[model samples]
Target: MTDRLPLFPLNLVLYPGLVLPLNVFEERYRRLVRDLLALPEGERRFGVVALRSGREVGELAGDPVDAVFPVGCVAEVATIRPHADGRFDVVATGATRFRLLAVDDSGPYLVGEVEAMAEPKGDDAEVMTLAVSRAFAEYQRKLTGAQGRGPVELPELPDDAVVLSYLVAAAMVLDLSDKQSLLVAEDGTVRLRAELSLLRRENALLEHIRALPAVELLRQGTAPN
Candidate 1:
């Protein structure tokens, strides 16, 4: 489906099925929250595109087209709390992937002409799903130990390959570009293969280093996935 969506360019990538919490402290984003709140419950959503080369809180020096990645996730508001100070505490869940066709910056916040992306389960999706899950389990174990925490407990994973892929993409402690690659993968099988490679690389690094930088340092100001 093709439609225009309010856009929120962030420093991080959001994957489908992941939960994102935001403190709407910026005036433009506070306005974005108010506008979404006015919509019907099911229709309250916006596009969350990762910034390519600009800060999330301010206007870019160049056009937004040069500042944001082409692919983004649709964030559907799940819960919202408005403060007396006109800020909002909003919890949104990633609903679908979209390709940004063009940008509109006349409004307070960015808006996009976006087309919903097709979600395909490629031929090897089932096999790759199992492989990625095993790799991720080991990766999580190593990551936990590296964090000085003992024994990672794997969460209950969904059987659907697409959901599983996005879940792993969200849960992994990786760089923005790495996660963005996963987000833009053409299908579940492709994403799972990429993730398998990433998980192995991370697991190896963790094994050799035996330590990791604090997650907060890596994730910066973003909410926990």
Candidate 2:
């Protein structure tokens, strides 16, 4: 079934179960925030589509966004802070996945007729979830080290396999195409497999870099080498 919801097109992708902090400075988006907060708690849900190309609203001048993968996760406002400058600092938590059907030009923000995506299912889902979680833990460690930070504290994620898939999807640094593929994946198993593959590739790259002798490599092109 299709339903109408307020759309917020961004330059980033949001995955279900993830928390995204947004700074609402533009007048149009400030209006969007106002309208969303006015609604009842249960009805305060919106879609977050990544802007493929375009400047102003209703202008389709930029490169066309990949229509085949035009779905984004629906998010609910978890916290809202009104600023003195008529802007807002809002934290939204991904709630459900929604597929955009059509864009409506009724409000300051874009509105879309969307259908919620279904959760994944399978038999080996539990094992897949565990594996994905492990991968994320390792990735988090590497990320923290790379950022010159201490070890990261892992969050208490759900035990269910499907939930794990969403968590991994949210954490991985997947490109647009991979992210879109995850959004349209038929089940958690498929998404988990994809994320695992991505993690493995990243791990391989990191390992390759770590194995290289930094000093010697740097000395190769130096004078009198």
How do the residues 1-225 of candidate 1 rate in per-residue lDDT, one tens digit apiece? 689999988888988887788888888888988899889999999999998844654756568888889999999999999999987888998899999999999988889999999999887888998898888878777777778985655676777899999888888887788889999999998999999998888888888976677662113254421
Candidate 2 displacement at residue 128 in angstroms: 1.6
The clash numbers for all candidates, in the given order, read 0, 0
Candidate 1 is scored at a TM of 0.92
The whole-model lDDT of each prediction reads 0.84, 0.69
TM-score of each: 0.92, 0.79
lDDT tens digits, residue span 136-224, model 2:
77766665555556565667767777777776665666566676777677788888888888888876666545332222100112110
In model 2, which range of ten residues has the least summed lDDT? 216-225
Cα lDDT of candidate 1 equals 0.84
Q: Residue 113: error of model 2 in Å?
A: 0.4
Q: Any idea what lDDT model 2 has?
A: 0.69
Best by TM-score: 1
